[model samples]
Target: MSPLSPVLDGPLQRSWPWLLAGALIYLSFGFTEMMGSDLWWHIAAGREVIQQGSPWLVDDWSFTEQGSAWHNHEWLADLLFYGWVRVFGVASLVIWKWSLIIATFCLFQQLLTRISGNALAALLACTAAVAIAAPFLDMRPQLYSLLGLAVLLELTLFRSPRLKALLPLFLVWVNLHGGFVFGLMVLAIVLFPWRECSLAALRRAAFTWSACALICLVNPDGLRIFCLPLVYALNADSPYRSLGEWRSPFEAGGITSAWYAYSLVIGAALSLTWLLPAVRRRVRFSPELVAIAVLSAAMSATSRRFIILWAMAFALLLAPFAGALLRQKLVQPLMLPALLALTIWGGLRVAPYSLSSGIAFHYLTAEYVFPHGLADFVEANDLQGKTFAFYNWGGYLHWRSDGALKVFIDGRANTLFDDATYLDYVTVLGARPGWIETVEDSGAELFMWPRGRNGVRLTRGLLQTGRWRLLYEDVRGVLLAREGFALPVTLRLPDDSVDTQLTAAYLASKKGDTVATLAAASRAHEQRPWGRATCTWLRRSLQANGQLREAESVMEACRAYFPSKYLR
Candidate 1:
């Protein structure tokens, strides 16, 4: 057969529109560089498993819970992730993640095409789903969750519902990640209300759901894996709830334009049924569809993280309505023109035009993911033991420290910590009542917090306790030591410059060491002779440290440095 024959008449010829459309979706999403902070710990955990040959029952990266039992359900996904790194290196992990994302969209598009029949509607729905789901597209196990959901729907919902086919899927799903529970829920909803009197279909569906439920027990955790989803769900007070991803889409504020676009697509797609009576009539509403819609919507309303799942539900449930709307008497006239324009747009986006900086390979660089400088300083200083850090920075700390230095918390959240732990974290970070006592109680030796509302407040509390000394301060994060801890002599030395003396004085004041700050600032002023800045800084530092008497002495010294200004 001629090569052109396949393009002209084969399955490839028939599906080229959606094939191209899926390619466009993949390219658009692939262009986004994966730079998740939590990727570090996941990678580290995977490496740990590779080294030890088993998941650690006790915590590996937290000082407070050093020996606490840990349940790493995503071990299989982590193994695959780190396996990619082992085989091809870090750069290949990026490609691996991108390949998974693309494959997910491809499966989703195929499912949509089967339901909608119209390629344009499928493309539009998939585009909106991709846009909404973009935030969750990190190089984490959640990528597997996305792909698994697509495959589950395609197999059970769209194709022949075989009981045996679903068992292996669930077996993999259960081991791959805790998201297997989501698949179980979807399966139950789909099978529970089979109105068809056909006994055989009902038996098959029932057997399929039962088999899925049973196979979930096949994981390493056995029975305990069943309780995990419930534990994760009931963790309402988790400090992770403070993260935007964990908040409800409605309650989540400071949204970008992409969210608005996603909202518009959802609204427009769902409204078609109501606006056009014929479209509503065309839809074959099943019990499964109704259940999924209500459940997915409720889940999405509870947390922004579920919005992607809800988006997929919407695309699957409303594809027929969208397809009907596209074929409407009023819409058909414009469909061809719109399709042509959309096709051109898709082609342009997918084509590698090379006008840009050649696909931004710099996104995965050290400057973005790793805290190399801070890690070096801490390692050099031998700063180990309990280290308090923001959740965002915790993963990087865990990874770079090679499990040697332990953090108080990390991105693992429900996997490693309980609600009480997260509550204590939130309370301490908020600088609320008993915050200083909480910090002291944790027995953490070092505090490293990123620059943020909570981090800044917590840092202030750490400094005010008169029990910590500043070690490193930068825009990215600050590292402080518990008092009585000695720093290297080189780090402790103040430079001769006025600015350096001021910085040193500020740090000393934070430590409540008024005498040291005053002496350092005095020396700097004495050297410069005409250094008004050093004298002013000395006076301020003394006042800040509550040395009123010595503060007056510095003020008097300032008059000597700048008589004209002091006299005024």
Candidate 2:
């Protein structure tokens, strides 16, 4: 073989075919799953960058906190993702993700190809690459680190034992994503005194390590970005705790999970095997595979999310042994490329990336899915002040709502966000006293409820006794005005015709009595003291609470008796 044989090797020797194969598996796997909030947030963040011409670090539109701390570490990736989604819509976003996966496979193959000189080792390494990278198949900036780290590992570990030569690449990897911490660890591993090789290998590794640190200074945050890992890791209950990916090692379940477990198992066996009184492979796991194995295993077992760590180490471990396992004859070269092309094709087909549509994905501004319609209703009814929201709807409401409507709570889980807030949030909606307490303390001017329920005690209790005015209730959302703001209790006497009639109808509706509903709505129409507006509120309350038929009957009767053209 010539000096550049690895680069110019034959189709069977190149290992590019296996790269295509590994990437194909990932592209295929992701196609069947739904694109989660990560995709939308990327688009949303991009818009912020475009609108502000800079990164965000505070809650701009949020009514609760105007200047809460924010993090834009993945700002660059989000802008690229937003721009792509604008151009091609979801298809473009999908393509970007798939392309990253394919590139990861190609990089892993290329690195191993140079080191092992065995085409089969390159192929197996790529295969192991696919197996390990399974859980990270989302539209997250983290993908940048995933692929970059794979390339970084191959360069630092398998081929040259010199860390200095690998520093420039490490710098690029660091600037690209926070996963650079793992890359730094790889360098330090090579520089350590291990049972693997002679002093010369460590010297080469140490030099590369020094050069890489220098290159890291070129990024935007300077060296501060590199230091953030320790800070973030130590932060209490940062998604790293509750989320499964951040958990301890692999336990069981899922199609792709076992790939990580397999590598941990195989690597431990091989690393221990090196201590045998036989053929010394002149190499040992630099950072002590046993420790990484235990940690990675614990992470995998605790959360499915950190499977990336398990996969990464597995890929590095497989690089040396690829030559032995992947020596089988190439099946069909054409099929491999076909898979690669299809993987790319499928990804582009899924991500909704387009600029002119003006319709952002749910994640981009999830809080504003139907802002105009919902906001107009609130304004027309004068529904404002502190309101309650479901668990994940806080960010959405905060973004879409006007200053009048403050939220009881939206998604920001602040330690300072009083325990009363959290308790009432779950209680009020679930109809659990604290409901009234949460409602009162939030200074709630409106209670937004999901469209149809038997009788949500929080909102219904207020409406039945005239404590709240049914200010706005449509199919999308419900808005109730606290009595003092819109209508005082003195304004609504029990037998005062309109008030009595509407109150009676509300009570019957709550009791599931259809017969009494129609009769009460009739007498209520006869006593329309506030004119058409009161009648309108009655109809809206009935229809919004699943009394559409009674609302129609009241409308018909009001038209027959008063015969006003404006009612139409």
Candidate 3:
């Protein structure tokens, strides 16, 4: 009695190659550099677990919260990542991430094909899904949750109406990520027979839900695993809420381009599902799909991270409607192949940029995104003591320095440090009134922070106090040591690349050395003329040195190279 059952016979049967090719190509978009900050900490924790033979329940990574209770969810996923890196290598993680993404999408594609009974319709939908998911497809424990949700949906919705498989799914899911709580909510929705409501069905659902809930307790956290979601929720005043991923998609300045695309696709799908009944008259209503969609959409409204779950629910809900459209005689011959061609074309365009041409593993640490160079300087000079670093750089510093530099704070956020500790960190980082007292009380010997707008004020405050010496600086980060700190080796500035030149220009400008600023900025601009930061710096440096004609020429060149909005 499926709405798409009528479309079971068609030319779409012969279009499997096109569908497969397009799916592979579209999924290929996930292959890129490993850029996430969380993965380093996850790998570090995984190594610790492997060494200790059990997950650590205390925060040992940071000096700020040395003995604090840690949730350590995703321990299993961390172990898997460590084992893969141990056996295969770090570069192989990119492949591991891609494989999980492909498998997740395949599950989604399968669900769409089963519900819609059309491969072409499923391919088109999945292409959009991949686009929506691309930004979040980094190599992290969350990838396991994504794959777990897809498998859960496949078992409950696509396969026969049975809840037996959910036991094993929840058993593994509860350890892999805290997202299992959301899965449990989804299972509750799927277990209820919306089409046929009876006492027998309700009783069966209750039994299955109880069984799944019990199975979730098999992890190391025991009963504590179920309370993990509540732990995050109750920490309403936690500084982690400032993170963009935790922000609502509808929040001002929080909406991403990807969320916009997701909205358009979901909106179009809902329109088709509701309006198509007028044209076809035989369109069927699925109350279960509607209920799940409402739940997921509500969650997505609160946090952007839940949009992937909403995408999964909406896709299945959208399938039959997509299939119904595919069945029309006029649409079948003209529309299907055109959509396939467009998907293939998109795949071809993205493939070259997406595929790894042998993994450049150093890019993970070497890139400007991290403070790898500062870490190198600290390690080479054998510098030691408690370090206060940017929140994002803590994991990299911990991993790259091999625990030699104990950080004051890290990405562990609410899991390790409480709101009071985070507020103190915020106070010092922002260079607020009590920042000096806060820093002194913490006994931090080394200060490492980004050299960008966020850290410039803190850096200036430290320098102005005459108690913190500038030890090292790069385009991305600056390292300062408390006065009287001994350096075994004399500190030297690296003049190797545009990054260093830009940093030199910035430092010179701060000291009112116009000639030095212009010199450094000119070199940086010549090296990377297309760089927005470099161009802007070079123009300002030229103007400061009284070269107005040259500054105007640089401005004209920058305007030609970039959009007017970007120049502004």
True-structure RMSD, every candidate: 11.8, 12.5, 5.1
Best of the two (1, 3) by lDDT: 3
Residue 231 lDDT, candidate 3, scale 0-100: 51
In Å, residue 505's CA in model 3 sits off its true spot by 9.0
Task: Please report the candidate that would top TM-score against the real structure.
Answer: 3
Worst 10 residues of 1 by lDDT: 1-10
lDDT of each: 0.66, 0.54, 0.72
Per-residue CA lDDT of model 2 for 375-446, tens digit only, reads 555544444565654444444444344335555554334322434445556666566655666566666656
TM-score of each: 0.75, 0.61, 0.82
Off by over 4 Å in 1: 1-13, 30-35, 192-195, 198-201, 230-240, 254-283, 325-340, 347-370, 454-466, 484-568
lDDT for 464 (candidate 1): 81
Ranking by TM-score: 3, 1, 2
Report the lDDT of model 1 for residue 321. 62
Candidate that beats the other on TM-score, 2 or 3, i.e. the better one: 3
Write one digit per residue (lDDT tens) for candidate 3, span 226-333. 776645434456567766767777776532536544554665567455656574464466666777778877777667677677766667666666777876677768
Worst 10 residues of 3 by lDDT: 357-366
